[model samples]
Target: MAETLSNLFQQFLLYMQSGGFVMWPLLVLTIILWYAIGYRFHTLKRGSKKSVRVLIRKYLTGKRQKTKGLIDRAIVDAIEAVNGKCDGKRGREIIEDLFFPYYQDLKRYRKVISTIVMVAPLIGLLGTVIGMIETFDSLASMALFTQGGGIAAGISQALFTTQLGLVVAVPGLIMGRMLDNKANMMELELEQIKDILCAEKGLDNEI
Candidate 1:
């Protein structure tokens, strides 16, 4: 098992070397991108399978159970904000104030993910261009035939960076879109929760 792991590590090192210095930046970008993606996923999860109204009702009845997911926490806070006192516009404003952090949380790391997705491809393209330049320079100096792998090696490096860039970007784009959709849905649910709380004339009775 140790031998197998060693071989895998050796192969990974070789792969990184082939992609040249740009591989380091790409690797860093990949790390940051996925971290952001993971954070968004964690933040956006709906923890409970229950509908927003059901969760709100559960809390309003003084159940006050432990919460999970962004919406679940928001609902609990909203209930506490009113505490069977304020209602209508006043209650909504308070709820909104309470919810502001959640909205910000939903937005966290979204821009970082987006920026990395956009930049990864361009960075890869830059590597490709650099590789091509090196290859042509070798050819101009009549070293192409003398060099170990010559044009083929340089071309491989160029294409490898491009491939790695696309690999990093495509998934980030897809995941980013999915997370964005989830965030939007959660936002709407939050709005619905607010409206429900404010409109309920018998909120105190319910509690």
Candidate 2:
């Protein structure tokens, strides 16, 4: 086990050395993006699992009237504003007005995630280009006798950049897709919540 660990560490060290300085920043950005994706995932997961229906029912029926937090306050305001605009008619219009933005917000929550995922790969590509440039420059002044060594050094370093980019990009893309799905699922739930609320209020009387 220790031998395997040592071998992995040695390989990582070689990769870093071949990637040169630009790869370091890419590495840091990758770590930051990973943590951000994780954080967003946890937040979206919790958002999905939250009981918006019960909360709304409790507030609307007067079983729970206290404004406990920002989310609750938002819900109350939405319900009140919607109910008022509804002119106490208990129509679907009020429910639509109140929860459309909730659905929109769920969709928007993953917007930054896409940007982060896209940028990670581009950054990795940029690092690869920089590494290749350095490798070429080092090769230019080498003695003819050592031309093969120079070419090998340049090729190895060039490949390092590509590898680094993939290392960052692949995971970022995977996580981004996962988070996107979560956000989409949450939006679907919000829509369901909207439908339920509208029905409970008799707003769908037109249907």
Candidate 3:
């Protein structure tokens, strides 16, 4: 498996070289894109074993101050808000205020990932433009074309970069969306936990 993986990387490097200078930027973006994806996956995977509701209940009923992970932090905030018979609506607001920051934090790099997804193809297209210019320059010496048609080589390089751009982008975009969806689910779960805490804290159910 290691040998196969090494061979694949070698092949990819060859292709990148064929793509020219634009490939370097695309390469950088691709690296960032995958790094962001991997970070989100690792974060979500190593998240709380228990649900937000369970964590909230435990925190409220018991005495645990410090917390780790996204959901746990939100639950801690909500639990801390349970100041002896507080107004329900106000308690919910407090939870919301605390929860929103962490919710945003959980989705760290959401915009960065999206920007990379959108920009990668454009960069590839830029490569295509550059390739065309190079091809056109080569053609200026039209006398050489008849003897050794290098146009095919130019065209191949142009298309390869454009193709690679889309190839990198499609997966990144899809994975970004999936991560966004998961983040939305987590938001909903945190909200539910907030609601439960609010109910226990005060009489008004408006929150």
lDDT of 3 by residue, 146-175 (tens): 222356556766898899899889999899
Best by lDDT: 1
Write model 1 residue lDDT over 39-67, tens digit each, in one string.
Answer: 99988987778998888888888777667
> What global local distance difference test value does model 1 have?
0.85
User: lDDT for every model?
Assistant: 0.85, 0.64, 0.75
Q: Provide TM-scores for the models.
A: 0.89, 0.60, 0.74
Instruction: State the TM-score for model 3.
Output: 0.74
Q: lDDT ranking from best to worst? A: 1, 3, 2
lDDT of 2 by residue, 5-114 (tens): 99999998877776666677777877777777776665554322247787778768876555653345545765676567664455566666666665555555365656
Measure candidate 2: CA RMSD. 6.4
Q: Which candidate comes out best when scored by TM-score?
A: 1
Q: What is the lDDT of residue 43 in candidate 3?
A: 61
